[model samples]
Target: MSKYLLNKFLFTVDRDPELVERYRAEPRATVEWWESARANRILGCHADESSTWLCFEDAEREALAAHDYPRLFELGAHPFLTLTLFIAMFERDHPPLGFQTEYARRLAHVRLPYPDIAT
Candidate 1:
């Protein structure tokens, strides 16, 4: 599932204003571009030091491209990272707490023994 890479995508995109906008506006394209261009680039390291592996699985890619937060949670993406990035992208469209409420509601079906988040 590459939870680490998924979390990395959330974390990285959340921290950058432009990228956040880009992701919100062009999810599929952004996911594709990120996977192709940045997924293997080690953070805080030279480009040449990039890792050779770190691609999202097909389901993971689809979940991200679709902004399916509930699916992301099922895939073991870190909740905080997902929420933070999601809030940034969607909170503005709702009244205060509305998006959060919706987020929780959408994930209400998740039961105990949550998916393992450890990378």
Candidate 2:
């Protein structure tokens, strides 16, 4: 079982179904979705190099850097923590930090796209 309460990725985003719709509308969405878990992506493809990335759930940086263990209690340091932090950062003014991929065969150098849609 997970140590922290993960706000289910799919359900949380499902509150806005357009996200999935937009993903489908996109030219390509390279993901190995775990359908059993409501399309939770097990492995995501890096848009740049097609590198495979493990998916993390509900992890964050400030929640960690502050040594805020209590808040981080919910953000487990699993191999997949990289992807989870992205969710916790949703709608935040700043982009995600403290996320890293461990075993991507083809690592890609991705930069933050300006004019964030969430803003």
Candidate 3:
């Protein structure tokens, strides 16, 4: 799986407030649209500079589309990026610290030997 691409998606989406809201509200559509329109567009560069080789694997796509952060972690997405973006999307739905606690609880089954995150 392309961990770099996955992290790139998280990092990019997390940085843009509008995209963040879009992703939070319509994850599948956001992921599909991003894969089609933004995946290969080099950040801060002109559209002509876009690359042609970046795409999410099916698992990665589905995980992201489902807002399955735990699946993302298992698929080697960076934890910080995942957590930060997820917090932005979901924290408001809970009481203070409740989302974080839920996040931890959801990941409690993960063992020490986490999946390799290196791209």
Candidate 4:
């Protein structure tokens, strides 16, 4: 719902199908890898024990499990890649109920049918 630059995490996941699959297959390992990369300065993330970073990581996990795309966006997920993130997570076994559940969750926060939509 905001005009923001491409989100590093979602952008990366969007571009790399392999990475998306990896996250689908190994959420814990993927998070662990990110933590290692950030801690070792492999990624641009600062090597600090910042509570914000930890919170984001935890939020990411929760978002994935709950199929709460808006939650990810609130935690700095890319708006453009929001749908893609949902698709990636549920690609293997698409369940109607699961999709509906996620859709309802997102719909609750959606502002009308226009400008409030995430850019």
Highest lDDT against the true fold, candidate: 3
Over 1-118, each residue of candidate 4 has an lDDT whose tens digit, in order, gives 2222224455566677787788677766775664445323324445563323322345565564454566665655555576666576674465656764665677576554433334
lDDT scores of the candidates, listed in order = 0.95, 0.33, 0.97, 0.54
lDDT-superior candidate, 1 or 3: 3
Evaluate model 1: give its TM-score: 0.97
TM-score of each: 0.97, 0.18, 0.98, 0.51
Query: Which pairs of residues clash in candidate 3, taking residues 3 or more apart in a chain or in different chains?
Result: none
**Candidate 2 residue-wise lDDT at 106:** 18
Q: Is candidate 2 or candidate 3 better by lDDT?
A: 3
lDDT per residue, candidate 3, 43-64, as tens digits?
9899999998999999999999
Instruction: Output the better candidate (2/4) by lDDT.
Output: 4
Q: How far is candidate 4 from the true structure (C-alpha RMSD, Å)?
A: 6.5
Candidate 4 accuracy as lDDT: 0.54
lDDT of 2 by residue, 48-119 (tens): 443243333324434332323234333443324324443333324334432332222112332334112220
Error of 1 at 101 (Å): 0.5
Pairs of residues clashing in candidate 4: none
